[model samples]
Structures are given as structure tokens and as C-alpha cells.
Target: MSRVLIIESSARQQDSVSRQLTQRFISQWKAAHPADTITVRDLAVNPVPHLDANLLGGWMKPQEQRNTQELEALARSNQLTDEVLAADVLVLAAPMYNFAIPSTLKAWLDHVLRAGVTFKYTETGPQGLLIGKRAIVLTARGGIYAGSASDHQEPYLRQVMGFIGIHDVTFIHAEGLNMGRDFHDKGLNQAIARLAEVA
Candidate 1:
């Protein structure tokens, strides 16, 4: 059975554009793959704590030599990574906050992007351990940035996902949300129509 994991990081629980688009995409995806199982992790509602010095130090320790604290840290990291590894598809609802992803989402990334787990260092450079997984990122922005030269969100997101071996990544942008009602509606409509082709 195919498993899809959704990571939602919008602070606006029900009213977020990113979240809404993600839901639409998932609905379409489910319609296409009726037997797939979907799992959701809402980061804004249940935020993952930022990694601290203790947690960082704990991560550096060998798993067998870990103390109780280190063990707990390892367990948490393992749980996050395990979820990603087990998923056949990933959907991320990312809203642009200060031209980047929300901190809650970044915290989740910190937990899951563990060395020797999601990726590893080799003589040939760092290699991603996870493979054969596809990702769809639904992003919302205040202003119009679909094809602008200043839009950094899409490229940054692509680079980050690529770094973790998620090369088959697709982006759906709900941009110009804060511009005006007409622009917002236009942009959203375009995105929704495009979803039919991709999802």
C-alpha cells in the first residue's frame, strides 16, 4: 500500500491558503489513488521544539553509548526520520514567512535531517539515504512571485528538498494572496486548475 505523509506548518489553522491548497491537492491525490493511506503532521498546532545544545550533543553521541537524555533525543529523531522513510509520497504546506519557510517546519526538518539517517557523509561527498519518494510542496505568499526574478522561495525549497534526495519535487504556488481580491482569486484559480494536470 502507498503511504502519503503531509507536513503542515501554517499558523492559521483553518484559514491558511497554503493549508487549503494542500488539502485540495491531497483530495485530488486520494481520488487518483483510492487505496493510499494518508498521515498528517500539523506543525503549527503541535510545534516541534527547536534543537538545543543538549540535543545537538546527544545526536553526536553513538546510539549505543547514549544516556537517557541522549536516548530520548535519538528516539525523537528516529521517529521523524522513520515517518519520512516509510512514506511513498510527501506533501508540505509551507507558507512564506519572511521570504522563507515557517520556523515550525524548519524545526521538523532539523529533527529529520540527521546524519547517517536521512543522509550520510562519504568519500564521494554527502549522499542521501532516502530514495524513491516524491514530494509536493504547496506554498502561499503574500505578494505575486510566480515568475518574478526576486522570488527566492521556490528555488530555496527545491534546493533543500534536493539536498535530502527528494529530487522529484513539484511546487504549487498560491501567490499574490495579499495583493487584492481579484489577483488572489486569479492566482488561486490558476493554481487549482494546474493541480488537475499534476495531481
Candidate 2:
């Protein structure tokens, strides 16, 4: 059975467009593939620690050399990375926070995107180790910025996912969320419709 790992990064527990989209996607996906296994990791509720000296030491130092604090930090990263490594499908639910992804989400990314684990340097250049994986990103934005330079979410996510060997990616954006009712409804509706099709 296919394993689907969903990373939830929305800060708001209620009335979050990104979370709504993920719920819809989960329902549709489960209905479509009943045997598939789905796992959800909520960053807002249980946030992962950002990259720090302890984590760095944990990664760099050998197991015998790492202290208690360093070992704790390393364990967290290992757990997060292992979850991603086990999943065949990755789903990210992101809500725009000051024109970028939430800090919690960024921290989670820092934990999982490890050198010599997820990616490695080759004779020519860096190469991603994880292969045969696909990703779906559900983004909620305050304004319309799909292909525009102001839209930092999609492009940054694309680059990071590609770096980890997830080339088959699809982005469904719910933009104009803070705009007027017409724009909000339209954007959410369009996104939900697209999610239905994609799932």
C-alpha cells in the first residue's frame, strides 16, 4: 500500500483555508485509495525545533561523542526524516505568513533535509537520495500571486522538493483569502475544485 505523509503547517486551528483543503484532499484520497496509509504531522500543534547548535552538533558528531542534549535533538530530526523516507506521497499544507511559509514549517524542513541522508554530494554535483516520490502542496495566500515574483511559497517549495528528489509535484493555491468576499469565495472554490480533481 502507498504511504501518504501530510505535513500540516497552518497556525490557525479554525477557519484555515489550507487545513480545509488538506481535509478535503484526505477524504477524497482515502475514498479513491482505500488501502493507502495516511499519516499527518501537525507542526502548529507540536512544532519541531528550529536548527540550532545542538542539532548541528548532533548531526556532525559521532554517536559516542554526542551529549544528551545533542542526542535528543538528533533523535527528533531522525524521526522526522524517517517519516518522510517511508512515505511515497508527501502533502504539505502551507499558509502564507508575511509572504513566506510559517516558521514552524521551515523548522520541520530543516530537520528533514539532511545532507548524506536525503541528499549527497557527487563527483559532478549534489544528488538527492529519495527517489520515486511525489508531492502535493496546498497553499493559502492573502493576495493573488500565483506565477508572480511575490509568490515565494510555490517556487521555494518547488526548489526544496526538487532538491530532495521529489520532481513530480503539484501546487494548488487558494489565493486572495483576505480579499473581499467575492475573491475569497472564488479562490477557495477554485482550489477545492482543483483538489477534488487532483485527489
Candidate 3:
């Protein structure tokens, strides 16, 4: 059976547009693929701790030489990485915070993108280890940023996902969410329609 991971980073539990869109997408996706197993990681509700000096040092150390403290620090990273590696599909609900991704989602990415696990530096340069997984990024932006030259969130998300070897990444953006009530409803409807097509 296919394993799908849903990572939600919105701090707003019920009112988050990103979360709404992701839920719609997942519902449709399940309808399309009933046998797929779904796993959810709600980052806002259960936030992962940021990488500190101890965690960094532990990650850099060779596994065979790691001490008890280092091993403990590495455990979180290992679990996060293993989840990503085992997934056949990933759905990320990312709401733009100050024109960037939320801290909760960023923390999860830090734990998963280990040097020797998710990625590594080779003679050719850096290479991503995880492969053959498809990702759908459901993003909610306050204003209209799509197709704009100053939109950093979309490109940043794409770049980071690509770096982790998830090149087949699709973005479903629900933009103009904070513009006005009418605009927000319209944008959400459009996003839902798009989700129907893709999911």
C-alpha cells in the first residue's frame, strides 16, 4: 500500500485557509486512491524543537562514535527522516508568515534534512538521498503574490523541496486570502477547483 504523509504547519487550527485546502485535497486524493495509507504530522499542534548546538554536533558526529547524549539528540532527526523516507507521497500545508514559511515547518525540515541521511556532499557537489516521492504544497498567502516578481515564498518552498530530492512538487496556492471577504472566498473557491483537478 502507498504511504502518504500530511504535514500541517498552520498555527490557526480551524480557520487556516491552508489547512482547509489541504484537507480538501486529501479527501479527494483518498477518493482517488482508497488503498493509500495516510499519516498526519500537525506541526503547530505538536511542534518539533529547533536544532540547537547539541543537536548540530550530534548530527555531525559519526553514528558509530556518538555518545549517549549525541544519540539522544540524533533520535528526533532519525525519526523525522525515516518518516519522509518511508512515504510515497507528501502533502505540506504551508501558510506564509512574513513572506516565508512558518517556524514550525522549518523546524521539521531541519530535523529531516540531515547531512548523511536526506542529503550529502559528494565529489560532484551536494546530492539528495530521498527519491521517488511526489509532494503537493498547499500554500495560503494573505495578499496577491502569485506571478509577482517579489513573491519569495513559492520559490523558496520549491527550492527547499527540490534540494531534498522531491523534484516532482506541485503547488496549490490560495492567494489573496486577506484582501477582502469577497476576494478571499473567490481565491478559496478557485483553489478548491484546482485541487479537484490535481487531487
Candidate 4:
């Protein structure tokens, strides 16, 4: 059975297009692979702590040298990193905020991308450790920005995912969410249709 790890970052619990996409994905994925294990980490409900001195110390210092707080931070990072490492498929649900991803999601990424755990410095260049994993990103945007330079979300996510050895990534964007009724209907319907095809 494949392991699927889903990270949900949308702040809106009631009406979030990203969350809708994830719900659909979960249903379809479960139907297709009945035995696959699915794990979800909802950042909106339980935000991961941002980078701090304690976490930094935990990452840099050895176990014998780490303090209590540092050890706790290290343990948290280990758990998050291990989830990513164990997953066969990774799904990130992001709702665009200020032309970028949510801060909560960014914090989660910071924990997951470790120095020697998820990536390593090599003689030639930095090498990723979490290889042979597939990632699917579901994004909800207020305006259309896919394939444009204004869309900072996809490029940033692609770089980070590739850095951790998840090179095969697919993005499904639901754009023009805040636009007028016509645009909203069209964009949402299109995204849902594509979701069905892709899921």
C-alpha cells in the first residue's frame, strides 16, 4: 500500500477551494487505492512552529549538546521529516495570500527540509535525499497567474520540492476566485473538471 501525506494550509475551514480540491482528491484516491494509507497535517488548525534559536540549535548541535527545548524542536523536525520521507505521494493544499503561499505552509516546509536528513551538501553541489516521490499541489488564487512570472507560488514550490528530490510534480490551480460571478463560475468549474481527470 502506498503512503500519501497531505498538508493542508488554507486558513478558511468553511469555504476554501484548496480544501475542496483536497477532499475530492482524498475520495478519488481512496476509491482507486483502497488499501493506501492517507495522512493529513492541517496547518490552519495546528500550525507548526516557525524557525527559532532552539530549532536551529537542535539542527546544528549534537544530541549530547542539545538542551531540552532544542531536543524537543529536533524531535518535532524529525517527525515532520520522517513523514515526508515515508510518503510515496505528497499533496500540498495552498491558498494564495499576497501573491504567495501561506506562512503556516512555509513553516512546515522549513521543518521538513533538513540539512543532512532531506538534503546533503556534496562536493559538486547540494544533493536531495528524499528521492522517488511524487507531489501534487492544489492552489486557489484570487486571480489568474499560472505560467506567469507574477505567480510566485508554483515556481517557489517547484524549487523546494525539487530540492528535496521530489522532481515529478503536478499543479492544479483554481484561479479567479475573487473575480465576478462569470469568471468565478468558469474557473471553479474548470478546476473541478480537471481535478476529476487528474485525480
lDDT of 3 by residue, 47-78 (tens): 98887876886788787878887788788788
For the record, the alpha-carbon RMSD of candidate 3 to the native fold, in angstroms, is 1.6
Return the lDDT, model 3, position 178: 93
Worst 10 residues of 4 by lDDT: 190-199
What TM-score, over all chains together, does every model reach? 0.92, 0.99, 0.93, 0.97
Please say which candidate is ahead in TM-score: 1 or 4: 4
* Best-performing candidate as measured by TM-score: 2
What candidate 4 gets wrong by more than 4 Å, as runs, is none
lDDT of 4 by residue, 66-173 (tens): 999999999999999999999999999999999999999999999999888899899999898888999999999999999998999999999999998989999989
Give the Å shift of residue 75 in candidate 1. 1.4
State the lDDT at 3 in candidate 4.
98
What number of backbone clashes does candidate 4 have, counting pairs of residues 3 or more apart or in separate chains?
Answer: 0
lDDT of 2 at 115: 94
| Candidates in descending TM-score order | 2, 4, 3, 1
Q: Order the numbered candidates by lDDT, best leading.
A: 2, 4, 3, 1
Worst 10 residues of 1 by lDDT: 144-153
Model 2: number of backbone collisions: 0
| Superposition TM-score, candidate 3 onto the true structure | 0.93
Q: Give a tens-digit lDDT track for model 1, residues 48-81.
A: 8798765786788666777787777767777888
